[model samples]
Target: MSPMTIDSPVAGTAPATGPAPAVRLRGLTKSFGANRVVDPLDLDIAQNEFFSILGPSGCGKTTLMRMITGFETPTAGSIELDGRNVDGVATRQRDLNMLFQSYALFPHLSVYENVAFELRVRRTPKREIDDRVRAALELVRLSAFADRKPAALSGGQRQRVALARAVVGRPAVVLLDEPLGALDQKLRKEMQFELKRMQREVGITFIYVTHDQEEALTMSDRIAVMSEGRIQQIGTPTEIYDTPASRFVAGFIGSCNLIDGVADAATGRFTIPGVGEVPVDEIPDAAPGTPLTLAVRPERVRVLPDGARTEGGVHLPATLTQRVFLGDEWISHLALDSGIVLSASVPSGDAARALAATADGARVTVSWHPSDSRVIPTGELA
Candidate 1:
């Protein structure tokens, strides 16, 4: 296999900044018998990009990663890396390394040996292998634990050994298959930063696969939201969260108050039965009376000063269903007369405390700006 060098990008080379994507998938498909695991997936990941493929269990996210890393063959289409085709390339031939979900470290082996395993298999020079292993260990802050058996290391340390093994290969791209799934919640959170730092230090393209939304949002430069063997949408974490393109993307990324409504392009608004006329930004393709879904992030709705509204947009008389203090914010769950229950996250400042003093089940007005709502485009999300 030809060697690919890894170097830290100079200043201004943040994630997603560069020339062509380090990896691109064109019309890729994979099937088992008649069941398609990955259905005609298309994606591009820029050089040194920390890209995540996120979805639920049956979403085929794992299958897509496998194809990219050459662990599983795609039934059709091509895998391109650095502008060259690699459809028939075996796993070892591709400049890729993987950190398995299980850590997959050789438990019986010493940490140093496990970290050096890849180099030994490839007949790397003994002196070079030692240097690489030590470097990799230091990169993961595990150099001090190098000689311990895998069994003797803590879960996080064992995880570092797996990561050390993968980066020791010095591959151009690294695939992390739910690398933090095994750690406890607090530990997993800590590892998220560690993994991102490792990627930056090594300057290799990282294609991390996970079903955890928070993990992806915290670590990725871009995310491909996958479901049912396909990618629903791909964008930066903020893009995916703030402006989800479809119903699925909106509903999937986080909590949403989805209302079934109808749209009239002439009026540029949704005509919900009980909620009444709600103005919208863009006139959707759907004609009047067409069944549509309206999405609003819970935090976008406002329960504010009495008589705050002067003009258009919907405001339903509501009652506070529940309220919870969530650190820096107070989460108020409101139940509207329109049968819509939504959460409003208000900053836990003086104003929020005053509002909290209002009686639970107290009547209030829930309002939203036109720009705050998204009319889920028909057919954009299945």
Candidate 2:
């Protein structure tokens, strides 16, 4: 793909120049026949922020996106854009554009016409329409293919044409609904960077929705993880990944080893069934026997020889059940004596080579620093 160029904001409109957020939801919600898809939700998306709504399928992310685009009316509360209430505003009246997984381009029209369709419908002057369409095409690096029909373009090219169409109007926010779902892995990765760059160059707020964790982590300035009609947590990628506020957020963002336990606040230790007491850095301000769920990322756990000292770490005796080689890291699956499972990640160098040389059923001790464990409410374990 050629380097995309974004010269200026859409022809007639200036960039969103404000300290106010681009979009805000106050008590926003939606329900269907007693099933609330999106519960009362409040979110503030800043101007030019590449915010992503990430969750599993049926997690209300799409419904939330629709509410933002005005396609779905909220059951209660208000939708605001640029600090102005947009209640009862029609979809077309909202300052936003939506791009879906499918490239909804007109097959009979050339790329140029497809991109210019919106301008024509709005009765924009012919000169302005011509200039905006060309500019959008160039921004996506599809200017050379402007004369081609949708059928003549590849899947990525077709999608870019759709992007051009949506962005030519210079909406305050662009809502993307798994827009890269139809592409292969390689193309999807390439488009992630391209989308981020296009967003930066155009200086438009992008609200991307995806189930792919890596995609959200790669492209978003911040992410909102949703589940069961509510947000689990909202934060930057590192914060979400490193310090998930809930069990759902920890497991959803990446692989984790969640152990059920009861904490002894006085001793700063948590006791797990089948495993011995585990060290906790700071005890929660709870009773001595408070039930807690401890979460540790797979990569945070260290594997050592069976007799290695476990000082300053929670130690568990285990036997390697399996090992899988990822390009950059090796995953060692271990089964604890208590029958619980744990996954430990070994970097793809000496440790990985050493583990690979060890027998599959060899004994090992898994340990993690007390600070590496995140303690959350035991209710999430249910």
Candidate 3:
């Protein structure tokens, strides 16, 4: 296949001007025999941006990152780094570093030696290497542990040492492939903020690949959701979460309740087969009677006693089937009259306590404002 030019701007990224983007891909594609792992795609990552490639396993996210790092060759199209085409560049000469989930720290080497390994290989002057290594260690807050070996440090600290090594050379960009996947939950959360702080302090472009939705949302300046070798959506975390471009995005980014029904445009409502019509803030531009799907986040739903009045809000009859306590909040599961199950998240307070007091199978109503629900076309429900 020949390289194709991309005239339109990449999704969720501004058009490039002034200085070129930190990374650019035009019609980048990869295939192995009959299997296409990455379809032709266009994207631009700005300098100093914390970008994330998010998707489940086998969704081509890791393969795409490898192609960018020159570990895997693309079947077609081109890649540009800092406006320099690097289609055939060797991995080491790409002016970038990659940090893997495994610390990859030399167990026998001290933290300082491990961080100084790259410069030593390049025959960097001793004085310059010392200065850069100290700066990198200081940036990651590992200066005090410079003499410790990998086994002597905690998981988080070892990861920081690996991070210091990756950035010690001051590479133009860093590709992190689930670098925090090995840490404990609490340590993972701590390192998320630490990674963000290091990124800001160093001002280097970071392309993180992960399947954790919360992790991506917490650290990314922008995210590209991928599936079936294609980009499903690209936008800031708020845009991707609040205004998902497709049904896949809405359901994948967070916990959402999807309701399929036909749109009654004339009445500005959506009509579910047995649950009745519910008011919607904006009816899609399709003609009346068009099949559509409404997505509502669990937190937006409220569980109330049966026959409760819900003026100016959409409500549906349901039976409280189960309630789960999740430390900070409670998740109540309700079975709608139409056989659909909806979940409502309530903070651990009077409202949640009241809802939990209700017996299993108690009749109840679930309600939410029309503005909190998003409408999607039925055809895009995948």
Best candidate according to lDDT: 3
Query: Deviation in angstroms for 294 in model 2?
Result: 1.4
lDDT tens digits, residue span 221-317, model 2: 9999998889988999999999887778888898999888888877777889878788887665656666777898899998888968766777788
- Residue-level lDDT tens digits of model 1 in 1-382: 1122232322232344347678989999999999988888778898999999889888897788778877788999998876667767667666677766665677778989988776776778999999999999999999889889988988888888888888887877888889888889999998999999989999989999998999999999999998888888899999999888777788778878878878888878787788688788876676567777888887788886545564665677788888988899888888877777888878878868877888897888888877888887645554
Candidate 3's C-alpha runs over 4 A off are 1-17, 285-291, 378-382
Candidate 3: tens digits of C-alpha lDDT, residues 103-215: 57889999999888878877889999899999989988999999999899998898888888888888888899899999999999999999999999999999999999999
| Global lDDT of each candidate | 0.81, 0.85, 0.86
The TM-score that candidate 1 achieves is 0.91
Cα error, candidate 3, residue 70 (Å):
1.3
Which is the winner by lDDT between candidate 1 and candidate 3? Answer: 3
Query: Candidate 2 at 80: error in angstroms?
Result: 0.7
Clashes of each: 0, 0, 0
